[model samples]
Structure formats: C-alpha cells, structure tokens
Target: MSSCNSAPKRVGNKVKCNLSFFDTIRKRPIGPSGYQIGYDDLVALKLYSNFYHYEIDKLEHDSHYGGIFNLEFSLDGKLLVAACEGKQVLLFDAANQKQINSVDSAHQNCVNCVRFLNDKHFATCSDDTSIKIWDIRKLKSCLRTLHGHSNWVKNIEWSEKDNVMVTSAFDGSIYAWNLKSHSENNMLYDKVFLMNGLMRMKLTEDGSKMVIATTNGYMIIIHDLNLATLATDLRSFKPSLYRLMQISDQCYPVATIYNYLFSPTRKRNRIEFIDDFPNEAEVISSLQIHPHGWSVVSRNINGEENEEWTSVHDIQSRDPSDYENSFMYIEEDIPDEPEPEEPPNQRPTDLWLGYISLDEYSNHNRDPSQVSQNIWENNFQLPAMGILNSGLIGVNASYNAYFQQHPEQRNKVITNLPRMTHFIKEKNVGKGYIKELCFSSDGRIICSPFNRGVRLLAFNNQCQELSMCVPDNPQQLKTIVEMNDYHKDIVVSCKFSPTHYQLVSGCLGSEIKWYQPVV
Candidate 1:
C-alpha cells in the first residue's frame, strides 16, 4: 500500500512477484502423423517404453481424400496395390513404398475389393456391378471389363488352372467367364451354369466341384460336367419296385411273386404295375423301407433237398444272425457210413436262395420219406422262396427329420473336421471390421492397419531383446515407444509386401501409410 514500485519488496514475498519465472513447460517433438514425440536426454531411455530404436525416414499423403477400402500384393510380392472408395486403384513399390502408378475412375462406383491373380495381373470388383482385369505392365488402362452382373458384384475369384473367372452378385446369380475368349463380339460366355437362388459360390481346389451356399440355408454341390453324364445314364434304365408273397403249401408253387403299386408323389397314390407273378399269390405283409429315396436288393432261391441238408429254408432263418448260428447237416439217411460215392451233394432243401428260382420236382424214385432229394435226381424241383424280397423305403424322410431337429449341431461334427488350410483370428487391432487382410509371401510377419493405428504382428514369437538405441540419443536407447498411433477412424484395409519387410495401410480417410520394421 506504499509506493507502487516498493509494494512487492516484502519479506518471503507475501504477494507473488511478476519479475521473472522459470520455463516449466517442455516442448514435444513432432512425429510422422502430427503426434508429439516426448523425450528427455537423461530419462529418454527410461521413458521410451514401447517404441523401437528406429528413426522415421519419410511420410507421404495419399492421392484420394476419401477412405481406402482394400489392398493386395502381387504373387511375386514385389508390387503393392490399394483400392480407394473414391474410385481409384494405386500401385506402389513394395521396397520403398514409392507411388508407381494409379488408375483413376477404375470403377464407376466405389471399388470395394481387389485381388491379385498372379505376378502380372490382378482383378477388381465394384459396386457398379462390374469387374475389371488389370495388367501390371500396362498400368495406364484395364485389360478387360467383365460385364454381366446386374447388381453390385460382391466377389470375384480368378482360376489358376484355366482362363476362367467367377463372380458373385447381389442379384442372386453366379457367372463364370472365360477371360481368354472374351471379346466384344463374343462378350456372352460360351457356357452358363445358372444358380438362380444361390447367394454365394466357391469353387473347390481343383475346380471340379462348386459349393453354392444358398440363402435358404442349404449347400448344393454342383458337378457341372459330370451331372449331365449321370443324367443321361439314368434316363436309359427303368426303375421298378418289386416284392414277394407267401403262397400255400399244397400248390407246389413254381414262383412266388408280390405285386407293388408305385407311387411317385406323396399325396397322390397312382398305382402302377411293378412286377408280375407266375402263379396266383396273396400279399401277406408290406414294408415301406425308404421314405424319400430308392434301393434294390436281390436274392436266388433253389428248391434242392438232400438227406444231408446244407441249407435251411425258413423265412425266419434268413435273419442275418441265423446264418451264423445254424447247424450243418450231411445226408441224414446215410447213417454214419463211409460210402464209396461222395455223399449226394448234401443239397440242403432249406437253402434260402435269392433272385432266381428252380422248377418243381415230380420224380417219385427215392423213398417217400426222403422228401429232401438232390434237385438233379428229381425231374423238377419246386422253386423255393429266394431270399425274401422285402422292400424297405422312406430313408430320406428319416434323414430330413433328424436334420430339422438339431440343424446347427448335426452339421457341426461334419464341418469341423480339419481341412488343409483355414483362417483363424489373431489379435483384434481396430474397432471397425477388417475389410481386407493379406499375408506376405513367406508368411513371417503380418501387418494390419485398423481404423485407429497400423499394427505389426510377428508371426514367429522368437526374438531376443537387443540394446535399445535411439537414433539421436544413446541415453534414450533404454526407453521404449508405445505403439498406439491409430485413432478413431477405421482402417479398412492393409497389405504386406511379398518381397520385402514393408507394410502399407489404407484407412477410412482414403490415406495410405507405409510402415517398415526397424530391423
């Protein structure tokens, strides 16, 4: 309250003095993506916790302002390609992450996907319902534009064996085209296999089979070439349903036949003559074996009877279990005597024959009690019932019942069987969906760029800790740099070079970032 200049000279500075103050705020270094790289010479090694001791070389901005959608590398791993939703496809050098060439307006709409068929060429599909083939040598223009799909083309697969390409569309059809023969005059494909209601189509390893996953929750296996052959063979044969009947004992029936009415449809019973019988027979029983499929079983029946019966002729004895337990009998009349003649072919009268039948026997030469005599000795041998012609139907019905009851679990056992190759989730790197992922040719390291940050994952977790040395500060070598650079936006796609240890990331901002390992 004294003079204005003399007021701040109090002991211990009861009031704060504004004469001077030490600079307490430390400035942070600017990083590649406008991030602050905080460091200290004395505690730099201790502070750089998660970062490697590498130096940032260069940074480049992508051409498009929209978001990146997909990325792929050529088979040789030397060239890297990226697709932007802004209708551009850029090819870059894998070694140095340098922009080699780019295609503008590659698609009328957003380029949703890209895939490399080989070292020289690749394919791209778009929402414009078109697929374009590109040659790496001539980066200026597309080699061919495949047109057929009416709606958005969701996926495209290039065949390695033949010059064939397959595409799936939202219009619920799959089209296969011969790329080699494609021309303006011959634009329409030579062969078309129409999958009217299928949602997706994937070819097997050899292209011999096509697995079509339908929206109705069924997988149809189509053998395109073989199906026609099978159909032709099937049309040449006549399929008949046959049955057997039990006739009386006195008639000495030569043949026992049962008539079956064929019904093709479930609701309508349209009776059709299945088989004919020689004698009047009565159907005692009928069995519906297969519910939805067809089957055929045949047997032979011979009315041969000998004293030493080797066969048993009872219908019940034909049970599979009876065959194992039945006894073997030699001629019963020739009592335990070793005769010079080989005991009359112990032809057992009870032998349950199948399919064919023998004639009746009228010869009254043997003893009346010896009703079981060799068929050759008797002028005519009565045809015994060949293996009982029992028909069972309705097998497919049972299979459908089981499938409907536990649909999810029934196929679990069949689908989970190990295959030659499969994809498994590693680490979740970003908040958004992984639009695209590709492995380096050798498959050592995997680089995934998410919406937030790009991640470098080591496939083989075997490495020793080397001395931590910063580019400028040796003392800061002990510190690590935390790798959490990615932020809010999604990283739509990422790819690794097959020839080098470099990675490129395409983010939602339509920006592509290049990353290389410190080693």
Candidate 2:
C-alpha cells in the first residue's frame, strides 16, 4: 500500500485532493475455489451489512460467473441477490453471509441488474433483451418474463405508488409494466416511450417525474406523469406536437431535453444560479436530487484548481428570506463574538492591478500621473442565472516591460493593442472524471466509483474552516476516505447499506468487498 497520508496537490492557493487513505477491512471472493478473486471480473457489489466481519463466504459457481454486473437486496434485507454476466442469479442468506440458492440460466444472456419487488419477489434485467420476475420460494421457475426491447436491458426501477415498474434498454426504449393488470397471455409490459441510448433512469420521490440519462450526454426530463392513468394510456401514448393526440383528451406527458455538456468553457469559480433549469455551463457527470426534490446535487465533469480530481455542487433556488430568518434566529440564541485585531506590522493584502480602456479613460478625464489600483467591491445587483464568462484576463509580461521601457510610446502601443476584459479557459485537463456516484438518503455521505477505487466524501455544509469562507474559492466538499489498490482493476458500482454503517463495493476483478468506517 502507498502512504496513507499522501500530500494533496496545490493549484495557486487552492488544494485538490485525491482521497487514498481508507483501510481495507475484508475481501470476499465471488467465484470458485481454484479461481483468483482479483481477476474474476466482478461488476457489482451486493453485500449486506448484517453479516459480522471475518465471515468468509463465496457464491457457488457453475462454469464461471462471467462477472457480477449488479446486486440487490430483498425488501426485508434478509436475502442478497447477485446479477451475473453469465445470466445467473445467486441468492445468499444475509444473516450468515452464505450462498443458499443459484439460478444458472435466469435469462438467455448476461444479467445486468436485479431489483426486488418485495421480500419474496424480485426482478432482473438482462443483455438477452428481457426482464424476468422471480420468486425465491420457487427456486426453479420464474413468475413472469417480459420481453420487448431489441437491445440490452440496462436499468429497471419500481414505482410503489402506481404498482408499476419502469425499464430502460440500450436500444433507447422505455417500457412500463402494470403489475396489477397483465395482458391476455401474461404479457408483462406496455410500451411507454422511446429515445436513443437511454442508459439509466431514476424516478423522483413523489413519482411525478423521471430523470433519464443517455449515452449521448443528454438528460431527458418527463414531468406531470399521472400514475393513476398510466396503465390506461399506455397504448395511445404518442410523441408529437400541435394537434391533440389521444392522450391529450386525458392528460399529456410533458417532456424536456437538455443537451448536457461534459466540458463547458466557463470558469469554475464564478457562481451561476438558475431558477428554472440548470445553466448547462458545467460538465455534469452525475445528478441526484434532495429528498424533497427542491435541490439538485451534481458532480462537475472536470475538477478545477486541482489536477485529476472533481467537485460537486448543490444547486437550488436562492431564497433570501430563508437566510435572513436563519441569521435572526442565530443572533438571538448566541452571544456576539469579538473580532480579532490586526497587527501593526502586517501589510495590506495585494490587489490585482487593472487598466481602464481608452474609451473609459477619455470619458472620465483621468490624470496620467496618479496610479490606479484595481479594487473589486460588493455590488449586489441580484444573482445572475445561466450566464457564462471566461473570467480574468492574462496579458503578456514582455509587452508590459516594453511599454515601461518606452514611456513616450506607451499610449501609442496600448492604443494599437486590443483590450481584453475576460479570461480564456485552458484546454483539456483533469483525466479523473467520475463515472458513477451515489449519495445516502440523508445526503451526508457520497460514494462514487472511480478508477480502481471508491471515493467517500463528506459535505461541509456549515463551512467549518475559516479559509473556506473565501468567496471565490471552491465549494467545501472534502474527500474523507478513499478505498483503492486492493481491487485489481476499475470499480464499477458501490452502494450504502440503508440500515447499517457499512458500504459494499464491486469491482471488475470479480470481487465484492464490504467496508466499514474505522471507529
């Protein structure tokens, strides 16, 4: 292992962190006894926190699990299921951390994901272009198998409010399955919508909206979906404009498309607040909304002021009244603190020197002998939204020296040269972009799958450090832990235990490891 206390990178006065300090607790192999766990191509982690540490458990193998693509737990948290690349579903007893059952050929091809409907009923999607609902009680058979997509089924989500399930596939089609009412011959799902490269889909807390992430870097937003009427309108649902369609008589689904850019050209330090939609000036890698659906947490595609690292932001409507109320309550409850006095020998802070343009100089009738210092002050004129700027300008040092040498020719040379007011961004940097990220239900802890490791971050919402109070500095998102190197290759997925203080991680090396914070 490398040094646990590895130094952070410094860019200007900012600190960039590549978290690499978490201690390994234990490793669980997923394949046969003779095979090496590190090279096993494990794609997902489905371990439960109920099992005590030091329990060495392995899922039984048939041929070999091509790779564990996704893992899920039953509702009661007693059973663990692993979706494998060999179209297999392995069931394990969570209490003892041992394999109890296995379905060798659950699907025609590799299984991509597994989600539980209830304790005994669970659903799995596969690359074979089908979805299967299985009951653990009847180990040999599947309850229902749904097929519609022409490409691989990538994701599946259950909506409890409507008693329906939504699935997305690689072919860009989305299907809705009405659990209460199936078609004549046990046809599980009815077609809902179609779009290209729909890789992932997540439903909001209230089931009013669905956020779809595509392979082509577009986020599809579907709003005002009436769950009560979804089953009835499945057949007549159409995507078009102007003339009233069949669903228009009832309720039409409102959809919007945002072209998400992974690399935006604006400066990172400037704040952009939007009231309706995201500004689209930053590369958004992953997006998660708060439980209330009022706030959005997004991971920027690239890390600024730091090398090979990224940052996250909490974007919400700015309510000045909320801050004022908070400030009033805090003032009434606490005593005032005294301000520290500055030392006599301390010099004033240095300010960036800027030159006024010829037009402004001519209008103001400025004196030539007096030196002007650039002083930026608080000029609050309402926060801007969806605005982009390059930032501060950079001029050639040799040009400045040449103007200084020839004082008489300075005005002539300055007049000829173009005046730049904004800064230009640097090209292509920050290779360590996050591919997948998940936050806990409470929004305190974030787990993201990075190259060969998992990044655990703690959000500093209170702004604890004094230096972090700087207005132009980066957000107070800190990497609290890093789990890496033990896995042979890239980590594909990670999840937090809903009921325990543990995290399960899955890697491409055919291994699933359960990690707990060292207390």
Could you give me the TM-score of model 2 versus the true structure?
A: 0.53
Global local distance difference test of model 2: 0.46
Minimal lDDT window, size 10, model 2: 254-263
Per-residue lDDT of candidate 2, residues 243-288 (tens digit): 1111122211111010011012211111121211122222333445
Tens digits of per-residue lDDT, candidate 1, 383-467, equal 3434321111112344346446644322121111111111112233322222444433333223334225543332112211111
Candidate 1 runs further than 4 Å off: 1-65, 183-434, 443-451, 456-483, 486-488
Q: lDDT scores for all predictions? A: 0.39, 0.46
Question: Which structure among the candidates has the greatest TM-score?
Answer: 2
lDDT score, residue 121, model 1?
81
